[model samples]
Each structure stands twice: as structure tokens, then as C-alpha cells.
Target: MRDLKDIELFLLDMDGTFYLGNKLLPGSIEFVDTLRKQGKNFMFLTNNSSNDSESYAEKLRKMGLDGKIEVFTSGDATGIFLKERYGTLRIFLVGTKKLAKTFEKYGHKIVQEDPEIVVLGYDTEINYEKLAKACIYLRKNLLYVATHPDINCPSLEGPLPDAGSYIALIEKSTGRLPDYIVGKPNPLMLEMVMKKTGVSREKIAMVGDRLYTDIEFARRSGILSILVLTGETTLEDLRNSSIKPDIVVENIGELAKLLQKESGE
Candidate 1:
């Protein structure tokens, strides 16, 4: 409650928080508009590593939001993390062509053979050869890292297999799991967010609908967490879960009104 006044940055989860499927939630635009008008910072923080930031930016543009707004993904985090931790190294990237470009942007050479490390992302363009090579590398005991743990990605038709699903298959084949998963609920993403935004944990808030990823990420990162019952979580679910959010609202629309009142807008 009191923390909202001090928050300089709002790290938002896209799918379930800002919109459900293709439809934008109530006050989705108004909340962001209000934040911009008040000179606060916000970023679309997503775990999807299949698509690059530009793809997400385009998606947002089609959804009636400003495409030029800042967007970050688990792929961005993984690339930055690898660069900072290991400098430039040969990476066996199992992801889309867009994702390969993302790693290249971080100065890492994407190679097919003799990779120093193996990185698994949401590879929408995954093929048997890619999987076979990833499994072979994992079997060789190379450093393994995955983008996120989400097993399924939401789509207009239904839930589609995501990176985590591929992780499971690779694990089964090589009997090895990822050494590190760099995504929500890991707190690594939050550290990257802090480094990029130059915002203190005390001045940041995570707004999302999922208790496990979004709220847990905030709890682990020592930032304020706001849960909106507009996605995967329900009030009953909250009552049953040990992981709790700092604040709960009916929806983003309600939270927007509250923010307006707090700011005397």
C-alpha cells in the first residue's frame, strides 16, 4: 500500500496481467498511460524466449500499445547473464533465428559444433537435429542453462509446448537437467532488471496475475508484489497458497483507480 507511492518502476507480466489471450484487460492502456504521465518507469517483462524483443514490440503495437516501449525477455536476460558471467564464449543456442540474433547482440558466437555451453530457449523452430545435438552436448556434461521453466505458452487456440517441455525431453534423453534456469521465480531476472533500470528493490513493484512466477519472483527479489485476479490465479488459490503477494486487487482496472487516487490524479 504505502510502497506503491515509492515505486519508480513497475515490472509487468504481459500475458495474464496486461491481457488474456488476444484481448487487453480493462485499464491496461490507462494504467500504463497514467504511469507515463506520472513519470514512472515500466517494462514488459516476459519469460517467452522464443521471440525476441522486436517481435514482442510488434505484438504490443498490434494490441494498441506503443511498440516503441521497452521490452525485455528471458532471452535478453540469458544473453546478458552469459556475457557477464563467462564473457564471450561459444554457445549452442537451441532457439529461434531471432533468439540467435539476440545472443549475437551480446557478443557471443552461436556455433553448431564444440560449444562451450549449451543454452536452451523456447525454440519454436526446433527440429530433431537440434534436439539430438543438444542432448549429445548435455551427455558430454557441458554447462547447461535454460531460459525459463514454463512448460506451455498460451495461444489463441490452446496452450502450446514451451521451452520447459523441451527441457523435460532433453533431461530424459541425457539424464541431466539444466544447471540454471534464468527466468521468473529465479530472481536472476530481477537482478538484470535492476542493473538495466538502475532502480533499487525498494522502488520497484512486480505486477502480475500468477502467484508462482510473478509473485514468487517479487518475494525472492525483495520487491513489492501485486496480484491481480485477472489471470491464472483466483482468490481461492491465494487462500490456499503459502506464497502471498504484498497487495491483491480485483483487476488492473481497480489497481489503476487506486493508483490514480493515491497520486491525486
Candidate 2:
């Protein structure tokens, strides 16, 4: 196992890794403080696309964390990736109006009538009308893309259905799955992070609570993975899972201590 001291950049998952609902996990603040003191960098990376990056930044700021507009989200990554591949293509966004605005901000053409691509995100306000339209669009052979495939999002209230669940519904109805699922655990997200941060894969570490999404992304992308027990995967889950993280801790608190000890700080 590689040492935490070797990590130069930290990629943090939001919902389960740093905070859930309105509460920050133990040591989340200290983790960031220590990284900043050591001149290391971290970025908040989330698969949820129902909200825009600005919204997340504001949330983090309210939670007493230093956040900026550049914090990455599955929605942002998907929009940027799509724009690069198919510039200004007519896109039918199956997401919140906020997410649609993001695509529009990038100069992509948004059309409900005849779209070239149908991008799905975590639409909390999803309704029958939206689903019906998405079904018809996909049936007509428009390219399908998903922000992420997280089946559930962890909230203080409880786990709620995320974009992946909606994607499943649409796929069942249209007999077609998304052409691409862009977000955590996907190389596209890591690629975008590396590009934005100017960090190499070896210098990056993905920290989260899930093995399937967070750790899988690190494993597949040749980056380090740190699993904290503050969220979804339990120790038993790790034992049974095929994918393994390089380091496992009870929570971010212990992780910060590990870094302090390693650096002799």
C-alpha cells in the first residue's frame, strides 16, 4: 500500500465523503486545513448533477469550507466533455433547469423538439412529462449521456434516488442505455480533473466511502484510493468486494492524523 504522504492532490467525493446533508463529517475541516498548510491541493468532485457547480460551492461555503466556483461536478464534466466532442450540438437535457442553464452557458444548443444528444442528470424534480419526452427522444436514436450512475444519494433524511435510477427507467422504456455515463468511477471525470488541476494520475488520490464508484475510479485511472468509513461501504463490504482501496480509515479524522504522522508534523 502506498503511503498517504505520497499523495499530492486529493479528489474528494461530496455527498458521502466530506459531508452528508447539512453536517460535515468528522475531520473534514481539519483535513482541508492540514492539506492547505502542507501546500497540497484538494478538489470537491461530486456525481450529482441536479445542481450546478455554483450551488455546491455556496453550500460548502455555508458549511464553513473554502469553496470556489471551479469545484467540479458530474454535470460540469459532462457538459464540457460533450461540447468538446460535438460542439454546439442540439442537446435535450433531462436534468434540473439549473443543469440546463450550465449547458446553455457553454453555448450548446438546447432543444426539446429535435436534439442530437439527450443528457440525463440528477433531476430531483423529475416528472412524467420529462420522462415521456426523454423516452421519445432516445427512441428516435439521439445520443444518450448520463451525468453519473449512482443509484442512490446519501442524505441526512435517507438515501434518495439519483440520476442512475432515472437512467435505468428511461433505458427500460426506450430499450437503449446511455451512450456514456460521465462522472465518478468514470475515466472521463478523472481525465477532466487532471486537465483542470494540471496533476498527473500518480499525484492524485481519490477519497470517498464507496468502493464501486470512488475507489473503482481510482483503481481504473491509475490513481490512489482512500476509503473512509463515514458513509456507505462497510468493512464487510470491502472484504466481499473485488475492488480494493489502498488505504482504509474510520473517517477523515484518522486520515488527517495519518498524514500528520507521516510528515512528522
Error of 1 at 193 (Å): 0.9
Clashes (backbone N, CA, C under 3 Å), per candidate, total 0, 0
Residue range 164-206, candidate 1, lDDT tens digits: 8998899789899999999998999999988888898899999
Tell me, by TM-score, which candidate is best. 2
Model 2 ranges with Cα > 4 A deviation = 67-70
Q: By TM-score, how accurate is candidate 1? A: 0.95
* Alpha carbon lDDT of each predicted model: 0.89, 0.87
lDDT tens per residue, model 2, 1-265? 5677778899898887888888889999999888888888888888988888888889888988874435789988888898888887798877898898888877887787878888899998888998999888888888899999999988878889988789778878978988999898899999988777889888889999999999999998889899999899999999999999999999997889989998999
